[model samples]
Target: MIKHIVMWNVKGDTPEDKADGALRLKTAFEGLMGKIPGLLRMEVGVDISRVDYACDVVLYSEFDSHESLAAYAQHAEHLRVREELGHLRIARHQVDYPVTSLPVCAAAEAA
Candidate 1:
């Protein structure tokens, strides 16, 4: 499986505006669930840390493979969502990596 993670710093002048932007982002991304192929799982989170350097929103998703993740980037639904929320983000960060099996010790502990 492939993991795709993204963090965003939303744009807003006030606390209320920021919250609204975060909510909008959360709703928009979550709306994509089941709408795209190879999207095994999707999650969106709004930061509550209230830390000065924290990102306003984060997206955690799983894809079946790297191809799936690549396809998602150009998917029409994704493009539409991006266009709709493009202006709401001030900064964006992302990480994409393959999911590996748990270490032997960690797997044994789960049992």
Candidate 2:
């Protein structure tokens, strides 16, 4: 499986505006669920820290493979979401990596 994570700093002049943008971003990305192939999971989160350095929103998603992730980048629905909300982002960061299995603590497994 492939893990795709993204974080964005939204563009807004005030705190309220930024919060609104973050909510819109969260809703937009969550809407992708069940709309694309090989998209096993999709999650969006809005930051609550309200700290100066925190990103406004974060996206966590899983794909079957690299090809699927690539396809998602070009999918019409994905593109449309980007076109609509792209301007609301002031900064974006992303990371993609392949994972076989998540590590579980021995104590947890014993329980």
Candidate 3:
């Protein structure tokens, strides 16, 4: 399985723009789930913290494989989401990787 993660920093040229942009980006992800077939799962939300690297939003998604993920990114439906985000995001960071096998340490986690 492949996991895709994305972090975003929203630059509110104005305070109002930041709030509105976060909502719009969240909306795009919710809407794309129905439109993108290869998307096995999707989750997105605000940072809600004061950490130094606290991005405005974090997106987590799973796909059957890298190729499927790639296709999803190129799909017209996703392109629409990007178009919407273009007006909202100041900067974005993303990473994709395979699930590494690890012991079930229930307490160890990072966000």
* TM-score of each model, paired residue for residue: 0.94, 0.92, 0.83
lDDT of 2: 0.94
Q: Kindly indicate the candidate among 2 and 3 with the higher lDDT.
A: 2
In the range 1-111, model 2's lDDT, one tens digit per residue, is: 999999999998999999999999999999999999999998899999989898989999999999999999999999999999999999999999998765577557877
- The backbone clash count of each candidate, in order, is 0, 0, 0
Off by over 4 Å in 3: 100-103, 106-111
lDDT of each: 0.97, 0.94, 0.81
| Per-residue accuracy of model 3 over 1-111 as CA lDDT, tens digit each | 789999888868765777678878888887888677768899999776847667888899988788889999899988988886786777889999986565367436631
| lDDT score for candidate 1 against the true structure | 0.97
Root-mean-square deviation per candidate: 1.5, 1.8, 4.0
Per-residue lDDT of 15-100 in model 1, one digit per residue for the tens?
Answer: 99999999999999999999989999999999999999999999999999999999999999999999999999999999999988
The number of residue pairs in model 1 that clash at the backbone is 0
